[model samples]
Target: MKTITKYIKISALALVATFGSCSKILEEQPRSIYEPGFFETERGIMGGLTSMYAHLRWIYGQAYWYNTLLTGTDEVTYAQQADQNFLVMDLSGRALMNAENSRADAIWGICFSNINTANGIIEFAQQVDGVTEAHIGEARFFRAFDYFLLAQTFGGVPLDLGAGELTFNTSTTRSSVRNTVPEVYTKAIFPDLLHAAEHLPETGRVVGGVTKTLARLYLAKAYLTYGWWLENPNNIPTYPAADRIDPDGHDAQWYFQQAYNVAVQGIENPGPFRLQQTYYDVNLATNDRNNELLLYADHTETSEFYNGGSLTWGNGGAPDNFAGWMLTWNYTEIRSSSSSSAWSAVSSVQREAAQALGRPWVRMAPTIGALSNTFADKTNDSRYDGTFTTVYRGNWNKAGIQGPLYNANYLPVNPGDAILTFLNEEPTQAISYGAPFNSNVGAGVLPGRADFVISPSGVSRRIYPGLWKLGPYRTDSGSGLGEPNAGSTRPFTAAKFSELYLVAAEAAVKGASTRAGFTARDLVNVIRARAGVWRWDNNGNTERIEDNSAAMIASTPAEITIEYILAERSREYFGEGYRWHDLVRTQKWTQLASSYTICGPNIGDRTPIVFQRNIENFHYLRPIPLGQLDAMEGDRGIYQNPGYD
Candidate 1:
């Protein structure tokens, strides 16, 4: 990422107040007055860090920004036609988003602002005797983390080392040239992380704070991303590269090995982190502070609400709340305000699923092929069943409020409705009509299009399977009033330790020079074992995906390849935010996307949608926001990325 952005939105002096700026550190300044030297004290240090985290949380939690990352991958895709920016991103054609793009600009601003704040903390904290190493370490970790994200998003950014701390004049006169991808990683990212690892404690801190293991995790990720960027098969490196940024030119193999080493260190380290016992527990809001999370963009039920509805009516623009993750809801979930009076020739199981789920904002939908491939082992592979909303134990308080409920499985007259659905299946031995009691029926068959029906009210509802993870069904005081809407309380899982298995396995299969003291197969099998997949040979502890090629099981680790690792990654972190980057870093965007042949039932008349998409090598990085260039007076040394208009 660029080290110094010529144009600065957040002034540096406002970050960590410098010492000696105040007449004396002895005087207690008013609560409102923020001047230099205040940050030298423990209170100022904590306040500065707290403010920085609050700002970071707001930046990372935007629905628009999150959508950009979630959809348009092998695991997920945008479904709504009206969300043009989402479509453009998911379909992969635009070099630059339209001039008024909010998500892109917000991310750019937030990342750079945090970067500047970190720099101030580091500079000021190092000068103070009372300030501890932990403070500086946290600052370094955030700096590295922000830069790493910027590099992944925008290729390269300015290298600013707190040069303008005394002067608040950031946007006017300060000029900074761009750094190369390798330079960002080697000089800034690597060094900051090393410092962070050195100072960050081994255990126990706030949920959002970094640990030694977390720092190591970021290092592994950095090495992998840097390695991939250096040896990108489709795109040539833009040089002359920075000094010692692999001046000797190592191949991707070496980088993968390095990544393996770092990942293994984090994996084997005696830390508080561990995978949750169940896949669903990994993301349950109640499990927000679980051991599986190394670090996450923290949100709470009261404070950091998802607040998606608030965005549309001008209540908030690109708000901080992280709600309405459309990735979890499939196309079938219809808005409650719309038609709900009729069920036309639909199974009772389908009705139960519909009733049980939260509000369906089907902006993004999973392709049928991706779903079939991902959940092929529906009976086992606890992940597939565990993560999705297959059944609904009716809470009559919520269901009864819907009023005049239809399904016989709904015993609202008694305790409540406890029913479930099998989207595509038609199991034997069931009542041909009313409510399905023991709905074990699997997908009966596929219509050439998606499996859905036009309700008797003539409303088109696409009924592919929906994930239960996205439902933040909080209140049921009234029907259709309390559902997952804009500004509603819904939590998004920003990061988790479960992905370590995937990352470690990717490095291992890519032929890490040395073993991680465990084989790639072993790493993957460990995850599978936790999931308790019934299809796998439990006694032998070997996975048994029917379609896994015979050649892949051969003698060497290379046979375990990137493909197997990706499939496993999708199964494990399906709706989580890893899909797009995973595809891009491995140079498999087009290859993986090209595999989509089968499609789901469409709500609209749009015909014959195929899975194959238009992803190009140039799409490896998103275009720098047009505003940034315009801010540089059109010629502040930074240039637009290649292939973007």
Candidate 2:
């Protein structure tokens, strides 16, 4: 990542107020009110350290872009197709143009921001008398972590080792993509991580400081990346040929083994942390310890509350609650009192909408169907239950009303328009539909009705039920009038612990060859047992589909190669940002090109819609933005990567 300079331009006198003791900490100080001299005091130094924590916030929050755009797209097979979503572009053969167009820029910005904050903290904390060595170690650990993110994203980013010299200008050009992947791993990230592992106490020492396990976790990830990056057989300095090799030509296996060793160390000496037991425990709202796997970050309730809702609209509420609309109600069936009666009333309207929209009412393509069916069969797997809600209908209640009878699966009885203006109009008369409701309601109130009548033929009348149960509102009437408070009382966002288990499983599988402590089959069985699978076995012949029930279980080690790992990662971490990088790292861009189909205004009938995976060059790199290139002076070799025109 390009290390952007952020000089704290505060007055020397005001610095005292800025870095003073926690009691004297300025809650409402002006942004420009800084006093470098105050930074000399113990309280001032601690205050400055608080600012570093704030910087860490940016890193944790910024992962959503990768989670949403890269992972949720065809980059990984985690996400199935959806209508009118940007991921469709990648899935449907769209070339990501430059850094400006790609969402990765936000990740770059967040990571660099973390690096700057760490640098500032390290530089300033050293000047204080009572400042402990542990504090300095923490700062260095964060700095290394920030740089690690840069390396993973951009591959050889400029390294900024120390605070800038007086001659350092903000306009100083980027350093050459110096430090090969191995060099960055060894010289920059590894040293800091190792130092952190040694000096940083146990996990509960502080809220967001580095721990021994976290350092190990990061080291494992870095080593894994190193192995992947180095295992290119086509490269000039290839390892001994597979046929001539002693261990069946498994060069990549060595790197995976290193990663595994680190992970095992972390697992054994997990400090104060431990894995979450249940699916609900992993969520930010409910899980207090956050999980043994989570290295650092504030474990406050606000962090939990802030992280909910869909990709389009953040944690849903009054003004910005459009995310509910973006959701296509296809997962569970929307059954009425009787299937025949509801279908008779609503099927024709649904057919018309399908014909006009040129898409199915329930957008379950072959891919989605396959995956959903697979998840259905894997009931024993904790991930299947944790990631998705299996219960067809949980108790539902009206927004303001309070009554046991009122709690039922409330499906929308109308579909007026795709736009929001049509949604606010509530349907009065209930239309009976089958498992998945597809009905519409009309506008305006009818006789003896307080709400708008269900249009016997409109789209709004169609039943599309949301998966989770809605929170209770204030009223006894079931008219859907009350709204939940944003800060308090809202539906919880489920982030299952099963994901952490999957990460552990992958690490274990990769590490099996080197450690001799545990085999891949053993790791797989552990996860299977957790999921309650009766047919669990370590025979190495059991095949498991990535997400779908239809995948043939692998019977051989060759079958459980990188592709299988990628598939498992997709199924386990879908919608959480694992797919995007997996696609790039595994050179599976061609598979991404094959799965998508696009339809919209700017896009015409682009047949055989697909993106070519330029793996030889483009896979490991992204093009620098043309606008940035234009703005920079001189050759600005910094602005252009190797293959761009």
Candidate 3:
């Protein structure tokens, strides 16, 4: 880690930041705010606010940063063709995440820049005419949002970025100091969120704008996280070496109670947000930006200007929604024979901009535990179907191949038939692994089946269920594969309304006093009940109308424990970038994600091998970016997180 001076400088440079449609169905404009007195004008305030929203693109949808969020978790691990960027984060004895190589570094600069812009807006917005409390409240919300993320990932961070604490810094100062965790929560995160929740409007002016509910969601989440820090039940260490004491004179239980109260309040006053009708609808590509999504980094298929990146081709960079590509295995390698007797194979499952098949980077894969254990009751639960693309259907006709051709077991398959299917469970008969009959992507052949089938236990790092929730979608494919190479145009969901229930339940389990009708078990059952409803069978590829809510509720334990809450959270938010933070907050990362089972990266390696993670106590907090250290003045040892230096 080395030291530089402009770390404190606000990045209010002129740029085109697109704000998604708010009051109108479609709206976009460029807003440029320069540093000098920019915040004194209404336009500057507006531009700065837009940048706050735009910064999410750099963090949420960016694949490398996404790797930081889930790669080492119980959900996923590094996949075939993974570079060091993916490998280091896996924490599985491959390599450690140093400051230079860590993709968590991506958030460091972007968040600080946005925090400075937010500081500018909050400081100067009152001087501008027509700047409402709501406007300033948005700034406060973003400022706290960034700080919350930073604190969670890197322990304590600098509040005074060369300007005094929470002030707009115009001067470039090299020196920086880290704030303690409690100081960050009480001084910056909690105060800002509380103010924003009170002053912000009930609903957002724009589709993904910050609203009171969104603010309260973060507020509750922050309180919950801080409470865990204060409790330190596992005795995990914190950086900047501060004691586990709340500056507000509140104990861990008090904060947990506050978390419960705020989450309950948000649920009670959900304004325009609510749970989608079914779990499938929540992450359906077409149903994106639905009522359940509180905030998202928006992109569109209509225009590149509005979308912020090329719609037809993505370079796998920031501002491009390409996190979908990471989990996507090369389905294009799936082969179907043109002849019945001869082993003449043709690529059948070509890459397409469908919800199931997209451009595959094969950089990350879900763990076997994620499939077999986490989603154990695959038959009863609809989440496994909704969350992943378990079956790869034939679309060779779209690629100009007439498939009345023979597939696995030399079975006749037509266009729109099942090409490759990841079986829900191990079949009664032994899966045929090697032959002229099997597919190249390590999928096995089941007797009398046209599709190449891989059992849940046989899922490899190279071939497994792709994430369907964040996959690509397009209306313009027009009887052919359309824009499979493009970054996903659907908005990347960052927050959901269903989390209020989970958050409240988690707090309740942590000894927060319960309110009537909102007990810990009651809150969790609401989510479980919704998981029972099904509008579509994702694996079977058919319409399935069913209401098994009572069954789902009956399955839930009467005494809801923290473990159950964590499991349910995984079921709901799997592969959506919540696992790491959730596990870290509960001090359950090492316990839950310490060891995972996955087959080798090579094709045809279906032998599951257990891999152990080298998740040290210090590994909980990600290393501070080496670039930040290079730019700062003074002892960088004091600035970086422990064990990284």
For TM-score, the strongest prediction is 3
Q: Give the local distance difference test score of model 2.
A: 0.39
Q: Cα lDDT of model 1 overall?
A: 0.55
TM-score of each: 0.76, 0.63, 0.97
C-alpha RMSD (angstroms) for model 1: 7.9
- CA RMSD for every model? 7.9, 11.2, 2.0
Tell me the lDDT of model 1 at 139: 80
**Number of clashing residue pairs in every model?**
30, 46, 8
Residue 158 in model 1: shift from native, Å?
A: 0.7
Which runs of model 3 end up more than 4 angstroms from their true locations?
1-33
- The candidate with the higher TM-score, 1 or 2, is 1
Off by over 4 Å in 1: 1-38, 92-102, 161-171, 236-245, 248-251, 303-319, 328-356, 391-404, 408-463, 473-483, 486-491, 533-558, 594-608, 636-638
lDDT against the true structure, each candidate: 0.55, 0.39, 0.87
Quote model 2's TM-score.
Answer: 0.63
**Higher-lDDT candidate of 1 and 3:** 3
- By summed lDDT, the worst window of 10 consecutive residues in model 2 runs over 351-360
Displacement of the residue 528 alpha carbon in candidate 2, Å: 3.2
